[model samples]
Target: MTVRAAWLLPEGQTREDTRLAPVTPMAPESELRSRGGVIAGGDPLKATGAGLMQLRIGTGRAIVQGTDAQGAYPIAVTSPETLTVADGDPQHSRIDSVMLRIYDGLYDTSETTTATVEIVQGAAATTPVAPPLPPASLRLWDVTVPAGVSAGVGGLDWSNALADRRRYTTALGGIIPRGWGLAFDGAHDGQYRDDGAAGLQRWNSAAGAWLPYPYDSGWRPLALTAGYGNPGHGMPAAWRRLGSMVMLRGRIAPTKTGTTIANGATIATLPADIRPAGGKEFAWASPRDQTNKGPSVTRVEINVGGTLRIFESHDLPSWISLDGVTYCTD
Candidate 1:
């Protein structure tokens, strides 16, 4: 199923209406814009293919059955252009709540005006077919609490999503609560959450949150130049990355200080840790001398493709152990 999010002009709404933006864009995706990016009033982006009549919403009637109370659902929209929730599995219960973003940007809720609509699932009648994303599994929710009774687990003050929609301890029932997502304390509150380029995740969606699947978020360790320093006590070396920044650190033995390396020579070959993106060049901090020599020893580093160059002040001064830290671009 595909849903749509829009900034509809209310019957009397104005540009200065002080209302919240209609659709909260997801993080790391639609936030920053480059030279070629979304501008105000830009048409919706293409789904999987090129231009298609993707976004559509209009007046719809909420189903009514007998005197249980005729509830009228207002303006239901699902399956935005960015995603599509398709049917799955046979036993999978044919109904549940789907995640969505209502307000795109920060705005005053007090100033915004709109009627509430209860979110329903599987076209308002869960009968097993056309259920949103599935793998053929049955989920039985324990929504047996009697009405008009101060109760245990109610889905929410809003949302008619079934009990299994939350974090369910049994059979992935996922009995998650409303207003909780991605960061719930429990083990599972939601279902498979797509991390864009990262991959997919499983959660309870309601009572639980998205499961933790830490990606190689750019902090990988790189083995330093092996045995490049003093023989048995080669300079202890380690390097790590964080986003666009790379940190390199190492220590040299006391006796081998000023006499360890050749003048104006490369101390070690760089690991992939600090290789600039696309092999492009980036400015990095100059290397330092930490032999407690104060002004007696000075060191500098130069990037030669993927090599580290070192220069010393005196070239042949006996000194204590030394430790240094330097940074580079990722």
Candidate 2:
């Protein structure tokens, strides 16, 4: 399915009586000129070639059934010529949480004034159907904070503000709360391509460097998603895998010194031993790493000294074990 996001304006938001912008163009595709790039309004981005277009607002609602409560959505004025901003109109508006409705049971939500609608078409830049880059298998992590647990997972410290929508690159790390639980999907960033060896790269914050994730000291198979490649390990090695899923569970730490876990590990056992101490954040590592070989992992990650867990399996029929633990095959 295709997903799309937009900004919904109130009934009188565009009213002449109110100092708001009006739709300038009647054509379907509108033009917008921003500081960084140009956008065409109503020109929603397609994810797949034949997928249906769904709508979502800031991190809320999934487009299924009675999913989203009716509300206004914010949309980018694609065409400046089509949209007319009243002279000296207020730059921003603080309204209720944004919501979007696509079809019946297919939608997404956004927190910003507007929603980001990713239409599900055959294939577009927004929706590249080609196989995911390199590391095929991925692990999912669920972070939860328990009440009265003295510790709390620190918020993601995105170097840039949440408002800036650019290619964000930062060390991924956080704490797992002691009480409540939070679950989300995640994956490796890119293919494995180190200046020296064949393993994946690990961040060394103290030394300020990029060393290989210890995948067998000298061999590493680039992990894409889960269940796509032959599971194996070692450094200086590369395996072209597809994609898979992972689950993470733990308590939110009170501080930033996060926990580390290797990719391909079990998600259920995390909460017991990984709890934070003295307000330090949680750190995690993955058994997989991305290489210049294949698909690019985008969504989620965990970190610490940048050296979480490492893997070396090159090919395995089912989920295997490393560091003495069996993990689900991605």
Candidate 3:
């Protein structure tokens, strides 16, 4: 056996001089960075229009496997490709598949090395299912044909009949597509993926799952009960969530200076979603008055049910500080 490497030609050699073999390995090398799928952008392999027993596939670029020895290759569809849909079974509904196929004459022993769109007709039975894809093929869409459907009679109901089977991939180190979630075997841990509707997600090897990106909820004003109001300062009673932790800040006072705040009086209620898993208590500083003598402390309780209350034995202070009050929501 002999070994052949590419691009070692001396100066004055044109690209054709290399027989394009040097460039052939480039695509497969880059394609291996990402799991095989359609490149994300511009309605790749999208179903543009449908008619009776027919479907049209829009322009797209996809990477798919070639022969095991040949590795992977890319297929580009510059123009719309129309495919014929098999007539539906008269007795039961059946699912058909639209596939993008590659045929390399050198390796596949075909007349020409080319890529084409083909339809794999499903079996008609009481419980019909989509046909399995052939070797060197990628499924672009799954089409459902109801019983007794035929050409030139009625068009397929695209909304209900077509299912998008196209997944996406990007340059190396970019967020992987949602469809390739299970394809990675914990080797790509710490990498991110675009989870479509769920937004961005990160792979966790330990948990063997994709976790949502951490986020912080901006501060929102806390709804104070009757008689309790902002202390007329810039800092108003507010709460926010930072990942699993919830933080509270601001100061609250009675609407009137002389208003009597009974012991264990409710100050405000926390939103149900940000409530703590268990009851929590915090010691907060309160303004000192003649009745309280010197600096005083107030006990603030945040119950599991989201009630925020204050406990004090002596007369209520002018204002209570809720700043520096933080707890874990979990």
Candidate 4:
């Protein structure tokens, strides 16, 4: 049914600054009786919520949804003005910042603050008269990747579908300070990527490896507790890593020789951080001969836990140099 035509202001809008638009009910003029500025709405001819209102918005138009003649209701903004938004001049303020977060089902969440552009209205690429973008460096262009929307509706503001803002921290979009950056406490494989100021490094949480770029600044060589649960000698195993490569060396005098030492005695334990990336075996060399003590030194294995095992040693006092390279982390 037809009701009194009046101006309606948008929600959250200030009463004074907000402008109300003229409206026309869908029913014919004679169907409903209008006196003064009020409308007497009824059934069959009025008061029904089936009627719509037509209004002119800019060079385009809009149709407002109907509601109870007594109660006010917002118009369902059906459709858009394809010719105006895509072909006419629109007003907007400059947005100084924007952020984008990408989430994969695997719990792999990452974000980028370097999003380089702001989306503005104007899609009339087919119009013979080309539309101009805002002056002074503002630009608009078509890209292969588009805002996620129905086909043919590219670059429409779909940012409302973005992830929750609370999930992201303030350190994003700023030159973050290390050691005090984020307080994740600790997480599985808690990875971090740093800028050149820290030398482009990442946390090798799985292996406990250090990071580097120019090398010297972020790396250090240290001594590992040589020997596993069994400590036979006071051997010191020194190790250092750069990138994925590891270098370790140590010397130990075995108490057992030959088959007696073949019990897989762990002579030196390396750090728990190195992984066997190169697949290279640990090598040992001794000056002892067949007549020395037990049997000649044979083979050894360096574990990721920094454990160095002497598979075969000859004499009780012969010194053997044990060394190997791995890409593992502790």
User: Which candidate leads the pack in lDDT?
Assistant: 3
Q: Give the C-alpha lDDT of model 4.
A: 0.31
Per-residue lDDT for 1-330 in model 1, tens only? Answer: 222222322455443332222322211111131011111121222112111211121221111111112111111222232322223223334433332222211232334433222222353233443234221111222121122212123222212222432221111222222311234333323334443344544444352445434312333333334434433454445565554556555543223433455555545566644655444322222234435444545454535467655555643322222244444463
Put down candidate 4 lDDT per residue, 129-222, tens digits, no spaces: 2124321111212211222232244333423211111111111122112321233321223333334254544434554543444233223334
TM-score of 4: 0.30
Clashes of 2: 142
Kindly give the number of clashing pairs for every candidate: 39, 142, 0, 19
TM-score of each: 0.32, 0.15, 0.57, 0.30
In model 3, pairs of residues that clash are none
Every model's Cα RMSD, please? 17.2, 25.4, 10.7, 22.0
Candidate order, TM-score descending: 3, 1, 4, 2
Q: Indicate whether candidate 2 or candidate 3 has the larger TM-score.
A: 3
Candidate 3 segments exceeding 4 Å error: 1-33, 66-70, 104-112, 177-187, 215-283, 286-330
Q: Number of the top candidate by TM-score?
A: 3
Overall lDDT per candidate, in order of appearance:
0.32, 0.23, 0.70, 0.31
